[model samples]
Structure formats: structure tokens, C-alpha cells
Target: MTFDHYGIGHGFDRPGFGEAYFQAQGISAIHVMGRGDDWYQYADMDAAMATVRAATEGAVRVVTYGSSMGGYGALRFADAAGATDALALSPQYSLDPKVAAHERRWSQDFRRIRWRPDSNGPISCSARAVVVYDPIGPDRWHGERIAQDIACHLIRLPYTAHPVTTYLSDAGLLGPLIAGLLDGDFDPQAFRREARRNRSANGIYLGELAASQPRRRVATALSLARRALDVSPGNWHAQVSLARLLSQEGRHDEALSILAVLVQQSDRSLTYVVDLGNAFLHAGLTTEARAIADEVLSRAGDVAHLHAWAAHICWLNGDVADARRLIRRAVTLDAGNRVYLRAIIDYHFGAPYIAGVRGVRVTSWLRLARWMMKAPLRPEPAEAVRRPFPFRRRQDDSASDSAG
Candidate 1:
């Protein structure tokens, strides 16, 4: 079933995956698509359930399948719609916060869910429920809440994140797995064995493992990241993570060698170029680093991040005058931000850099002072910046904590 589509990732099939395979097996599938907080508790619930009843009238069994938010819906609606089995990948017991107080991963989505129609409560289904999860993944934290009342057959695929369906899709095993469950012939060991063999799954698992590790364990983390790159060399996320870890370990030359190719291949993505510049600067190649900043400034329209990166690089190369000018340009581009204003003050500027302003406005300076009072997450892996943080691109998708 399709979950809420508000913040979908790349390659997510809006209709759900696997039509040909399901048809080949003579298994007809019904996709229940939800908008916002309907939770499959859609306004047309009665009609939808009646439709399901009509469709499964003579069928031997019915299985409801979904992952993440869809998993949340499938399990909750399974019994209501007379399903004989539910295959929930990374199901949440609730987004209500009241029932699932310990859960915290998808708090943003949680606020979007309706409070009255709670999905965390005990389900009425008499059929078997199968929950596939990564025990160490954040999904497990939510999955366990429903386990207290429901006797679910758990298949732990550790290190697989919330999107276990991606792994299932890659392995071409979703149809077979569901068929097995419906036929009472489900084999967890065989299924796990088959799913683990998928190259995409391995790449995801290794990359996630490397990313989740602490920086203090740099050597081991680097080894895992390298393994991930071996599995999926074209994965940009792994490339950045490896380069950053390498740079952190003072192996800047190695980082530069790896990132140089990526910078050109990526068509000078600001993130890659910034990372490349960072590598060159750290590796005692300031001239090459400065050239990269100059190239970005020369080619593009007014991009706040490009100017920010150029400013940082200029400051490093003892071009304080250019650094001051670039910082002023960055601040001009993002006017409302007090963070940038304080940077101007830190640059020893008495007046606001804008030509029309009389001086650094007292009110703006006060706003900057207020901003300094709070501890904010920034210049770190977790902070998704628009301008040049020299890390991940904060695209129109969900941000990850360790995407750097």
C-alpha cells in the first residue's frame, strides 16, 4: 500500500512496487493510498472495507503489505478490512506520542497524524502478523510498542533502515515472501539468506553502518565506508562520508585524490566542490583550493553558499579583504539571518555592508545578540545548510543525521 506521499524519496513507486510479479502468481493486490493523517482511516473507510470484502469474498487469504507509514496503516487496517495476514515492514505502533512515548524518530510526521483515531491501540485481527525490522534501526523502537499485545512473527534484518521495502524490492522477494506468509510456508532463514545477497541491500547496510559509527573509531569506520564504496562506487553519500572521514584523520591527500574525480563527475555540485576545496586546503594545496572558489564565483548567479565557501577559503589564504567582501555578499543574499550579521561584526565591520544602509542597525545587532544566547546545531553533520557547509545537499527530501 502507498503511504502518505508528502515527503517521498527518489524512485518510490506511488502505486506500490511489483505488479508483474503479483499478477504472475495470480495474487491480485489492492493499493490503499492515504493522504496526510487519514491513516487508512479514510473518509471512505466503510466503502473501502466493503470493497475489500467484495474482492476477497471467495479468496483463500488476504495479506496487507506496506513499509514505514504504509506499514503503520496496513497493520492497523488489516483486521478492520478482514485481512487474514499483515506484512508490515518497519511498522509503528503509534504516531500519537501518548501511546508511543519512547518513539522519537519521525516526530515531524507524528505531528501530522490525527490524535483521536489512534493506531497504537491493540488491533482486532485474528490472523498472523509478520513484522520485518532491523533490530538496531530506529524502526524497532516504534515496532516494539505493539509487540506487547500482538504475537507477531518478527524477522529482524539489522541495519536496514525504515525503508526496508527498498531492500525487499531490490531482492525481488516481496511477492514470494508475501505468498509464503499467506500459504503458511514462511521461512525466515531462507528469506533472510536471499535478501542479504542483494547488492543494494549490502551497500545500504554497509554505508549506514559506517555512517552510524563514532568518529573516534575512524580506522574501522573508514574500512566499512571503503567496503560500501566497493559495493556501490557511484553512491555520492558514501563518497562524501569516506572523504570527510579521511580528511578528519589528516589523510587529506587521500581525500583529495578521491574527491577530485567526484567534483568533475558531479558537474561541480557545490557540496562536492566545497569538500574538494576543504581537502586541498587541508592538504597544503591552497592555490588549487582558491581556484575552485574563484571558479564557482565566476560561473554562477548569486548563490549564498558559494560566497560563503569562497569567504572561508579566502580567510584561510590570508585575503582578509576578499573574505570581508564575500561575507558581505553572503549576508546580502540571506538578509533575515542574524547569524550572518554577527559574522559581519566578527569581521570587524562597524556598518551593515549594504550600500543603502546608514550603519549596522541597532535592532539587527540586538537580534544577533539574542541569537548568540541560544545553542544551535550548525557547522556539523546534522545541520543541513543551504550555502557552503561543504557537506550534503539539503534537497527537497528528508534529512539524515549523518549524511556527511
Candidate 2:
């Protein structure tokens, strides 16, 4: 059985993570999906477990596997489903503020979850467990916590960072490694050698590594980005990295040239659009930035971040009234976003970047500052910005379906 990661889906009928790959191999598998970013902490979780248990009954050997949030789910339900082995890739030990307070990456989702006792508790399993994570990444803390809870083998992929599975997959190691692990013939030394050899060809790894380079080593970063593009031309992330680096070097035309194609090819992806808009703004092309905002807003409504982006563009273009209106809309959509709130306060009372404004309404500004201090530092959910789950069915669809 496999469980899905965070933001993978809100419903089923669409394939769960690894569903297609397992199906193509003629392997019997069941997928446990969660609604929204709930982290499988559904109100009917016990019932969902019952379904999984019933489906796995009399199985010769059961293995639960998943990555990230899915990884957590695999370990969480291993004992309940009578699994012999649980394989988790970049799994969390807990998302509860009290249990894993140091985990700030997924705070937005954490706040949304009404944590039950079982939801974010330590893993307790008789099953043989293996956890894969980047020791240098935030997931190291999570992997360590899982180790503290139970006896489990920890596979540390140093510098691979969070979503280590993506790195492995990009390096053409995931399928083979997973197969070897499941079949009990996995060799860590061999895997590491292959990964090391393939790392240069992995676009995600290359781009991230490039982005992580210090300012003084920007030449090296640019070289790495170009190498990423050279090896993986279709990788938009690599392209974006290259573009951003060019922009950093004041190569505006070159940056715009790269982003222009990306923005066109991305089917108006808000993320890419925002990047392009920011690139324009950075290049002192306010007219182009305004045009991009206008085109996006004409079609893209109900998204907090889009409004925020548009508001920012408008503010820089000296349209304070529209900026204020748009920013307020953004705050209304996502009250917890500190960035949007800060922008609101900045727009009304003038920030450091905006010039020629006397400190007007000092008392109101103080009140807003106090409110900002109390606000949760949460990013707006992707669901709020994009139609992530196009085939969102009934909430109970996964629970009701018979396991494969």
C-alpha cells in the first residue's frame, strides 16, 4: 500500500502517488489518500484504517511505502495494516506545533490540521522500517525523531535535501533502488556511486545546488545553472534558475528573453508569471510588469498571492488606490499571511522603500504593527492560488473505494 504526500490530492479517481508505476508493473497496490493538506488526519481516519486492514487481510507480506507526508502515513499505519515493511522517503515524525515545533516549513498546513492524538504522534511499529532523508536538510530532524521512536534503518542522502525521492528519481535511481529495497538486495554503496555519477545530469539537484551558492561564488552558480539547462533543456526550474541568475548579474534582456518563453509555454502558470513579473519590475520595466499583472488578473481571480503580486506592481507604478484595494482583497482571502498584511500596512503608511511620505496616522500604524506581530506567518495555500485538484471528488471517495 502507498499513501500520498501533502498537496498531492484532495480526492481520488485520479491516481495516487506511485499508483501508475505499480499498476504498470502488474503489482497489487492500494492507495490511502487524504483530503486537502490534512496529512491523513481525517475525521474518519479509524474507518479508513479499517478499510485498509480489511483489504490487506491474508496477504503473505505487506509493505507500506510513501514519500514525505505519504512517508509519514506509511509508518503511521504500518502496524494497523499488518505490514511487514514500511519504506518512508523524507517522512516527518510529526507536524504538530507542540510535537515538532522546530518544523516551520509546512506551518500553513500544520495550522489547518486539527491534530488528533494519533495524527502527529511518534511512530510505533513492529514492522521492519526504513527511512530515507537528506541528513543536511530539515527532514534530518524528522528522520532522527523517527529513529528515537522505533528501531529503523536510516538512509542518509547528504545534501539531497527535502524530497530526496525527486533527486533519486531524477538521477534514475528511484525505481531501481525501490525495487532492490523491496526485494531485499539493496546495496547502499552501489546506489551512492550511481547517484554521485548522475548528480550532474539531475536538473533539480543542479538548480538547487546553484541557487545555494554564496553571492561571491555567483559565477559558479551561473555555470551550474547553464550546465543544468545543457543537460535538461525541458526542465523549467533549471531555466528559471538560469534566468534569475542572469537577472542578478544585470543581464536584463537575457533574463527577459528566457522568461518570455517560459511565461508563454507555462499556460499562464501563476508561479512562472509572478517570476516573469518580478523580473520585469527588477529590470525597471514597470509597463511590462503592469501588462503581465493585468492579463493575469483578467483571468485569474480568487487567488490571494496574485492579488498581492498585482498590488505590488501597482504600488511601484504609483497606483496607490488600486494597490490598497487589491491588497485588502488579498488579506481577506488569507488572513494569516504576514507578507500580505505587511504590504497592507506598508501601502497605507509608506514603507522604507517608498519615498516622500510623512508619518501619517501614527496610532493606526502602531495598531497595524501590533496586529502584524500577532498574525501567523503562513504562506497562502497553493489551492487558494491554483486549481491544484481539478478532479476533486467527494471527500469520502477514497475511504469508500475497495482497495486494489
- Among the numbered candidates, top lDDT falls to 2
lDDT of each: 0.66, 0.78
**Which stretches of candidate 2 lie above 4 Å from their native place?**
135-137, 158-162, 264-269, 290-307, 337-339, 352-404
Clashing pairs in 1: 305-387, 305-388, 352-360
User: Over the full model, what C-alpha lDDT does candidate 2 score relative to the true structure?
Assistant: 0.78
Alpha-carbon runs more than 4 Å astray in model 1? 1-26, 36-38, 171-175, 192-201, 232-404
What TM-score does each of the candidates earn? 0.58, 0.78
Question: Can you write out model 1's per-residue Cα lDDT over 289-353, one digit (the tens) per residue?
Answer: 89888977887536665676687677677777787778767665654344454555645433334
In terms of lDDT, model 1 sits at 0.66
Which lDDT tens digits does candidate 2 get at residues 279-338?
999899888898889878887675667888898888788888888788877766655666
Model 2: weakest 10-residue lDDT segment is 385-394
Show pairs that collide, candidate 2.
none
